[model samples]
Target: MDPFEYLEDLEDDRTKRFIESSNAQVEKRLGQKAKEVFPSLVEKLREERPIQLLVLGNTQAILYYGDETSLEISGRRIKMESRDHVIHSLERVWNSQLVRIGVGIRGSDEGYSLLIDPNGEVVGKIEGLVNQFFYQEGKLCYVKEYRREKSPDGVEPPVERIFCGDEMFPFYPGRGEWLSVTAEEKTTALLKGRGWSEATLYVGEWPELREEDSGKISSVHIVRGRVYYLKGNDVMMDGKRLFSSNHPVEDMKVNEKFVVLNVIKDYRSSLSAFTPSGEPLWEYRGEHVYSFDLMGEDVYALETSFTTSHSLLRIRDGKPYPLRVGRREEMEVKDVYVKGDVLLHGFLLTRGKPKGVIVYGYGGFSVPVLPFSSAIFQELVKRGYSVLVTNLRGGSENGEEWHRQGMLRNKLNVFRDFSTFLSLVKSLGGRTVAMGGSNGGLLVGATMNMYPDLVDCGIIGYPVLDMLKFHKFLAGMYWTFEYGNPEGDDRDFLLSYSPYHNLKEGLPPTFVYTGLNDDRVHPMHALKYTAKSRSLGNDVMLLVNLRSGHNASTPESRAEEMAYVMAFIEECVAHSSSSLHTFTIKK
Candidate 1:
């Protein structure tokens, strides 16, 4: 008997019925909301006619363009394409051209200004703009006096300083630059030069350093010519600590006279506003608060109800309008995007028969809904592969409740959820190809074992296959929230779903990929899983990269990985039979 057979046999009839009923309730509620919100979203995108969406990276910019059929990169049209396989990460975008900065594999690289011509045919590349590039009357101007330095190893470093007229300022790595006032004697002197007498010297750790460390900046605002920084729980203005706490500041934005701060502590969080002098203006406690946007004299915040619904709140004249945009009961927006009609939601299972499994839907973390704004997905979709993502309970899409449901002993729901999704897609006359990465990859493996008949083919990347041994590794210990501690009853639950222990004589075709330098999930997960699958006479292919880590380091490498997955899907769909012996695994 297989290890998974225990779970299949132990599933109680009553528990299965309850799970199905709960799933139906959620689907009815969310599916209705999606129907209402998506049509309006599509109309809005159509009216806005947003031709391009630009995303800034560390040293390069990604320009995304969408049409009726697909999403494509516009980098080539702008002449900002890199000859090297890896594109430079974009730091910021000002005027029309994308700005490239920061040190690369080569040391101390100079910042360059990249511009796509109006015709979209010619790209202009200007090097060494650190202190000399300026916007005069909304036009770009170059200062010739700025100097460039090359490291002893002959690598060009990113520009750190920029000269603005007679004054110089430090350029924050990913954020904008700060005014250089160190050469001036006093804060008043610096403010006086800028034609402001009462300007505060807004000081704190630089925004670039904060983004690199925490992955986000809580808040940034310019007041009286000084830039204030609110990072995590600390609020600082010109090196002065205005507020410090143990809480996590999730999001923030500035209005004319005050800076609004949203702080999250544990399960509950709140939103508040303060003056430049650290005086509190207003505060409200809530389960979750986000999407801080400023409009006129009133501050608008996009609020999410505890029930996974959404509404717009307007704060004006010190009063909060509870239903500014729509009634809480009537408004149910699951996922919001800048553009597009599809609103992705996730679910996790907690009380179901197959407890302890995680099912994630489309657009959970980095796994993404294939063919939905993902380059790899589009390529696969073009090849006639139907992709489906299961939002088992434990993903972020449906909020905290859904996530907690799929965690611990409830994790088996993830596998069950995937099985249901695959069955649904196949019923719709579409061949299914399942894919996942990291913890999600663990999900795909577990699903393949329990419902091998459902999944035709799978691509597992850097998966956590052996959940029993996962906590013994480095960052894997932190996953106690999802899988529970190995020493506890959760270990027994995890062992039930551990793909390494559950592999049997026959399984669907599968491909695994991992990086040698992956310090997070470790390469052993992929290696050991592949070895086990091969031992069971299953067709499993593994690809291990020598130099990459958790992320795809270069554009070419990303393209290659996508190509491999696409080819595998083509084979699975074309051949009809899910056989592994026909595929090859390369290192």
Candidate 2:
């Protein structure tokens, strides 16, 4: 039933020729501009800034001090020499050992975690286990999933098992969907999924399975001899309900005395603290908390806003005291209401009156589009581009209810939300390029198909376009929760808005790119969509980078790819029609 299924064969001669030819055409169009911009972009990317990793003690912690190759612990610096791996996270085990979670630069490469002792010696390296592992006594407890053969119609779930040091399957029996596991000495807290919609909580060395307290669990942690978790909107401790929040709890961190929660509502994130007994401590709102870590009872965080870079802050007495101040750029952001009754929020960032507008959105997976500084966007703004970042539905921007309004059968609400912003930008009279990646790519792809007249061009990167067969690809099965399963009754709904399936001749100029090494969002989505769009006489450019993955590669490769993207944007805006295209505002 899939016409371009051959594109999935990454090693096929025909597939290689197809991608090579498409990439050649794209280079012929925008390669010169990209080449000119590459050097400056690389310089911008390599700019040194103090990146705070984690807080260890009062003054001691792990961080990158204006250097990319080395990490400083307190004052001691250790250089990582692995060309293929980078430190994704750091966890302190016991008092003398640290675990550095290293993820592969390429998406296809399964990375390993390193256990380093006090002498800076490499203690152990465990492959396929990163942050999921926990230190218990002197042993390491972790979970690993063994992927099964893909089904022709349905998505196959991976069989997961728990491994402790050298012992195989010592703790949990049988196979299940293990999401995450945390341990405190002998006690372990495990989260196992019951399909994509719900996850059950299991605690103790030999965790007893309980069906109750199992629905919609976001996170779990075992701290201070108690199992603490966030279920729905309420925080639960040892199966006892703590206080509930008006917004969805995005992330949670715990120490000995208190539990900290990062909650999102109204396009902003707030950090709140509560005691183990469910007593409210303090709440810090306004700025977005990019990340947070606890050292003893002290809370250190990286927080920022739309026009500011991330700043290091220490929270005490319910206040954020800046340890390192962030730099504020010249970019001015205006919060604009896009829908009727001022229901939806979108922020327009511009340095001055712009020549063109870039409308960016990612309205899925309960992920909010918060305000944050980006070097790339800042440069684009300086070049007379107005960027509009929207907090559409299907995200936790408004709350769980807001997310519910844009998922499953309500997925159309996400596209409708995006269309509203595009219409607003188009009404203001300028070229509007819709841009997004991953889930956001799906957003732009679907909206452009439905409302091609509203956008001048689109940039869809590593997208999921083939909704009907998405589950059969790598990691696509996990997204069935947000996007309904296409194999069953959900097929009709998925097919209706599926970007590749809905392609027509009137689409705007589109730039579709994917990493050849990307294991998360399959490259087939981009390739097939580009092939079909070009076949229909639409101007769709395709680029497949072999060295990179779902994430970024080396700064040089990243800058090169970004230069191409910028060139494409410039070209599209230059060719955009000057005629005004307006739509009636529902409000």
Candidate 3:
């Protein structure tokens, strides 16, 4: 019988039993050693750090520690803010009495936008449709991603609308999520189209995007009584092009009479300010900036070095100063440098030559690598494994050009970047376990599938393996512009790297895991992948944690998942008979 045939029957008795049996086999093989190491893994993950989530609406931040969340100022958490769904976007009225929040719901990429009063009550809601929103003063405008049956593509794109004093229209037919609305007599919005590649400056009502003033616009903002936007590399105020740059404008921030533009080319960044009329006020050019938050005209610059350490700086009037906040000791990477465009960052925690190595990557969805609150790296490093983290293309490491260079048909560039980083680690003499989760899982999966010699073992969590059936999953349609629509004429292109379809027998011992409650990725991915690997007589394990969503909801759940993977790694090293470290697991 085909073991993978059960994949068509998710949560069925046969499939459940099969998964249980496979897990039990792994347990028996690990035996006492697994019992001895699980706790330390959990304990290491249990260590608390200063976690803060900012509510830019009221300039208030919430600190999450242990099982508690506290207001940074008064040390009291507003009761009704906590929920089962993850907070995606949030804002509060200037009065501080009203709050608006967008939440990611279960089993779908679509979520709800809710309005909460100062009395800690959810007074109003638009459930399971609202994706993002923009607020100015007390007025609210939002963008919705809903299925419109009229769309020939089966997936209706997203559209922006005002709340009409009560709520925004959810079922409106449109496309685009990267948008910002201004609260004027005639509302205006900056709309980004199709994977946010093209931007438009628009002003309209109901369903139309006014494009008269939008000529290859990149971004838009309204400040004071004036309007500011970017068209290509030129900064435009009102309808006239003002400050033009030879390089691309990466980011823009406007407030009152001044606008600050972060422009860059070839991995170097320069920040410059302009008056409302576009007169250049000041400019500073330096090393690549990771990102900066505009805190009332003051800048909190986030910088990441080759070492796994972060330094926050505050910039005012082009002058930068060290920001002292909750910083302790720092870790140094001996050879702190960059080769070509790939950032080769390594940390060796053990004294002698490392026995195990982990090459970490997350190149998809344009998520950048940062050196902050990385529990995964901390746990692995403390376990005596050398780790290499790469800031490859396909991420916003060097901005949009870098992202575009690795997307669509050019996605092979991302895979190539990972191969280059892995080759760098191999020269240092260690067998690497290529690792990633979600989109990163796709990264490691595709690379390992194409170049099996690059890694000894692979770990993929909540991954999208079957790119062919990917669009059928939650919010999968939206990502088509990134990976290409698998059902179209380009289906063959996707088949070239869909990990499940490209898997070969005799690959490394792979750990494929996901959650039962994973609404984002279909649970059948890990199930089917593991089944096929087993059928091909490959060494693979499927780990499932119950009642968890993508990224896992709570710390205990995270620790449980981490302990299982760590235990599996220990077993793999033990079987190879090159055990360099050991840990105790509690009863």
Candidate 4:
């Protein structure tokens, strides 16, 4: 059968009928059981709390919370930025869930770039994923990916565009490329690169955008009175080699006083700071929670590790001190280590002899999960399921080298690494189930196809399965460099590991999930894959929620999502745990 058979029929009435029937069957089977398990599970989830403070000023900030009080969006709990009087309140904006949207704060927070008032009102709106933003000369410039047209079938795969005030321009942009303004607020440096490999420098004067450059420079960073670019090993400051690093300049951050460059060598990372004239200032090599953010003249860093917890520290006078504090939950994680020849890292959360083993991992997109998000894993442990979280090759856990090792032609290594982890888990006995969402979902789906016995139940969400046609879908072309272009020379490679093309008749009990409003990965992926799986007489269930996009945004939606996951996990454990056994770890 053609793997792309269901592509055109996604919006057909027959497809809708099929999805409705699938939803009905799945609900009939698990609705009662879900009700029995989820209420208490939801209660237990309320115990875990996560709080975030987005700095707007020295004292003023946005306090978003995750707990009972913050049951929806990211829980925008407003705290007054004052030393004496304390006013804690939140604006009950019905659709007020904030996810990846970034808010840029100008001086005194007169009005935000998105026109979000201090009282939490989204007065103005913009279209697209705000990638890089800079505010200067009474104008805000941002680079984002947005579809040109606005229509029902407007899934045109967003192209990168630059929006400055009322004027806008389209520019081809790479992953790490960003928009930056010079310290003197004269020139704007735009870095255009593809997959962070080949960058063309474009330096123009403000909104005029009359960029004149040789186009050979890989990265462009404006600091103080000069513009710096990465050429070989030495840092080029205004056509002059100022300093050299031991390795390639992986990332660059600029401020008025300091130009910080991240050196990533063979999976290790270090941050080095330099003056505009290129005098070495300070170097730092340590594990931290999140990346540093630049606000006006200050570069603030948020420190959160398995040890120090979470706190926002300001880089003032060349030193970092606490600006705002964060709290860590009460749960503890024991027994963590690196594994495999590739140094794949993971931790196990075991409670007695676990009835079911949950293997969770995401090894794609160069993205790495930090210790700050162990709440869900902790909850999974509380439910008597031994949660094994693996950090595989595709992520930046070990820096850019690890990410490269899992991209394009080497993508199979990610699956192999994950499958190896699953093998190790299977040897531990108990009914094993694997969970992953988005690119992680692609990992689990591919693993299940290549090694079905590795997992008894597969929970795949908003995944890319039909690799041949994925690029035609929403924002898929943007990742062709990472996933390999199926329509190009990489076609054979993509087809080799494409999950949808390799599915067998005797698949495992699969619970395929998707959000109807998911404009990112396209819900048709889950729908068509589930349809194909069921046609082959595989035990498959399609679960979908209409209100979510990419993921469940609201607290209620997230709770429903958790309930479905718990229900599926419980069902799998009950049916398969009766036949589990213990075995020694494979060396």
Candidate 5:
């Protein structure tokens, strides 16, 4: 029933030609501009090496440092290096001298969780999507998904299981529910039910709770064999409430000594330290804390803002002392009211008066919009463009309720949030380009179709455009909880806003790009959408990278691709009718 359905068979001759022709047209049009900007763009991006810091204890820390091209680990007893793979995650196996590193190639779906000893040798390799590991005694226990055979309808569902040492436990994929493991003396597993409000805690082989304990537990941690969790703005340990906050506890990390709570209100996050028994110590109300860990009596945290790209600080007794800080261009926070009671927030980065504004948003999947990225924004700012990052409804900017308000049947709120922000930007009389990737791609794609007048250009990357059949693609079904079921009642709403189906003539100039190696979001979403849009004589450009995937792309490749995008945005803005520079403030 799908007109461009054949494009899903990527190996077909027609699909091959379609990719080739689309890529060729893009190269011919923007290749020179991309080349001219490649050197400076990559250098600007490379200023801050992608690094992940894991505080070991006391003053020691293990830093996993990498770029698009290479990766290296430091502060360990031995050296670890990788040139052909990207580091996805780094976790220390508790009670052992081993560290588990998740690594995979740039474009491939194949990955492994490698348990490395102090000597840097790979002591153990758990394959097949190994993730969410916990260590009990000296054994590593984790959740894994193994690809199973295709059904009669040619759909392959992964067999999920919880592997503990040598034993395996079957995991039921009930409405995409997931399990988490945490251990101190015993390996404890928490099976989160549908809606994530109810959770069953299993300690070793027995249930560790009564009927009343199955309440809205957001996050769980095992400290000294006691469960520390956040429930309804209250920090609870072993069924006893320790501290309650007016604002929601976004996240919490517990250690043997202290528990650090990250609380958010109005899109701003602050960190507070408390004793294991719920007595408050001190609070650090500053820029958003990216990540943090407790060591000894001090809290080590990474904070970032518009002006600060990265700030490593050590806090003791609520007083913070800077360890390292990286500065970036200026950023300002703006609040716009979509409705009388609904006040949306966002971050804007600019230098002087900009001729164009790039409204970038990713308002889904509980992810918050943080103005930490410097490279692309640097290049765009240098080109006289301002960047606006929106913390829309579907994100964790406000809280969990914000996420729930923007997902499932309430998904229209996310689009309305974006459209309202753009309406504000466009009213300022400057060319506005809407950009987002992954779920953000879906955001922009749907918004562009519904409110094309609000956007002068649209950049949708690795998008899910065909909402009706998106569940049929790889990893698409997993998101059914976030984006409602297409075969059910949600289908009517999905079809109403699905970008692939909603594409019409006179759409703003759009740049749709994806990769052949993107096994997560199928490339067909981009190919088919571009094919149909172009067939309708819409100004839609497509670029399918041969060597990249949805993630783990090298710096050089990303810089080159972003250059092409910038070129497209530049061209689109140049041709748009908006002229008045500088955002007009509504006084």
Candidate 6:
């Protein structure tokens, strides 16, 4: 008997036919729904008019609003000019009772310093080489920087550091109050301070074998008074070996009674709980039992899609019960983060298209209800847009298999699933504005190129456009698991769907944005797409941030980007007899 025969048998005629019917429904629904709801959304934008502003600060303060660009601050406008010779490095405006602006300025002679105030009025200036700062409790705390001699290879050598209140001690000798700052650095002493200082605290290095490993600490959790860290495949709790194996301990959680660890080896993951004294509590083996969150005495275990779709199981009274919040037919719950009965349930639903619903999927390692996605969708919904999130095949919702289904040759399933979702939305009277970023941006771009009439408007952010050329870059090599090695037979499938290769004469108006400093997806993706779209006479706009990376990390820049997106959507959805002029490709 083959190992995958079970999966093949489960893919019955019912499932296959359902998927096919869903795809057809999506196409018909999207066309009708987009025509219906677009006018209403556009009218709402026109009537409930709000001023859109783009604030970009570098060497000079720049404010761009529609066609009106200005530098001066007048009655309703706000402005601040940097006094330091350095470029305006960071800017954040906290709108509360009073608008607070925090700015970081770097000077050639003085190094980097931060200034904060209300309405541009100087509140206080902190002088030191600092990378960033945050407002905590009512005071500002700076992330202090320290200079260190470079290694022989020019890498900055690591130094031990400690954070005690607002001050950062680079070499604090205090007992029970030390943090290992370097890979080789060990906690020499446990400084006596707050909490339990005499508790067994262990620290060690964790060498990640997989490409996806962030190269940071593998695991960190404090059980009782003891701290346990996973270094490579070994679990060191209070400087004692608790579990040592070649298989990695993916995740761990602790409570007063027991410590639960999720161990991963290849495709399978097992959950085990143990006492603080190393006594085994319980162990269970399953495929993709990766993520778990505890609520009181019960632990919720989410199984990855294998024989079952992503299912939530409650482990209580030493037994597992399948928890049902909603019907699997109507909606598939991808993830559930419980804060009491009000579960922050992440889900995917397929409905017929006529409902003008924007179907959204995620990018990277798949984090649902992300700050960006939530905020943007909330604003859109407030402006009269129905939205749906598609926990598409490639994401982490169903564990490794779910993720694998949407990668390489099978990657088209994600787009098909999204299309089905849109159709379902349209059947219920909704239109869609498909949006995604980074790898998900590739998903959006490919969808728009392949299914030109499926979406009314597409937002592709820092997208990986050229699949054929993606692996030529630095970070692109890490995507082999998700995208497959392009040099292999998978290259044929990638070429078939690569957005850069599939761009044609007719498509919906597409908006592309990226950053010049994007170390992740090179800006050339946006640049080349813009050129091709223009060459094909498609209406497209490319907004390139002069200085930023991936998603704009700073608050002000992100706000400005969001404002731009809102304005663009408003214009696109507006009912007009005249077609908008296509933007010229900037060489």
Among the numbered candidates, top lDDT falls to: 2
TM-score of structure candidate 1 = 0.46
**On residues 110-213, what C-alpha lDDT tens digit does candidate 3 reach at each position?**
55666665444566777655533545435555554443322233434333343544654343334433444443333445455556455456655434446646
- TM-score, candidate 2, is 0.90
Output the TM-score of candidate 6. Answer: 0.48
lDDT digits (tens) for residues 1-587 of candidate 5: 77788899989998999899999999999998888888877775555432454554433334433343322334334333544465656666655656677766665465677876655567787876677676654556777654434422333553346666886644444424555655555536364544433455444422242332555576677766677777757888777788887776777888888888988755667888888777888899876776777777878787776666677888888898998876565545444344312777776677767788888898887777754655777778777788887778888766678888888888888999888878877777878899999888899989988998999999999899899988777767667778888999999999998989998999999999998878778999999899899889998999998877876656676777888998898788888655645554432
Give candidate 3's whole-model lDDT: 0.61
The order of the candidates by TM-score, greatest first, is 5, 2, 3, 4, 6, 1
What candidate 6 gets wrong by more than 4 Å, as runs, is 1-251, 254-257, 260-355, 363-373, 576-587
Q: How many backbone clashes does candidate 6 have?
A: 30
User: 47 in model 3: Cα distance from truth in Å?
Assistant: 6.4
**Least accurate 10 contiguous residues by lDDT in model 2:** 146-155
Give the lowest summed-lDDT range of ten residues in model 3. Answer: 578-587
lDDT of 4 by residue, 1-587 (tens): 66546543658787777778877887898888777766655553343232333333232233333332321222333322321111112211111222122322110101112434444444554543454555546665555555334222233435555666766654544422333323236666666555523345566665455444433355466655477776545677766777777654555666666677766533334567888668888766534434554566566665554433456666644566666654443443444443556655565656556788788888887676544444445556667777777778887666567778999999999998888778777765667788898888889889998999888899997788889988776667667868888888999999888878778899889898877766667777888788788789999988877555563244445556677777888887787634334433323
Ten consecutive residues with minimal summed lDDT in candidate 1? 189-198
Better of 3 and 5 by lDDT: 5
Candidate closer to the true structure by lDDT (higher is better), 4 or 6: 4
The clash tally of candidate 1 reads: 46
- Which of the two candidates, 5 or 6, achieves a greater TM-score against the reference? 5
- Give the TM-score of each candidate: 0.46, 0.90, 0.78, 0.76, 0.90, 0.48
Over 408-516, each residue of candidate 2 has an lDDT whose tens digit, in order, gives: 8999988988888887877778788899999999999999989999989899988999999888776777677778888899999999999999999989999998889
Is 1 or 4 the stronger prediction by lDDT? 4
- Looking at model 5, residue 491 earns an lDDT score of 95
Clashing pairs in 3: 36-585, 158-174, 158-175, 163-167, 163-168
For residues 180-239, could you state the per-residue lDDT of candidate 1 as single tens digits?
A: 221111111111011111122333332222111121132444445455555435676655
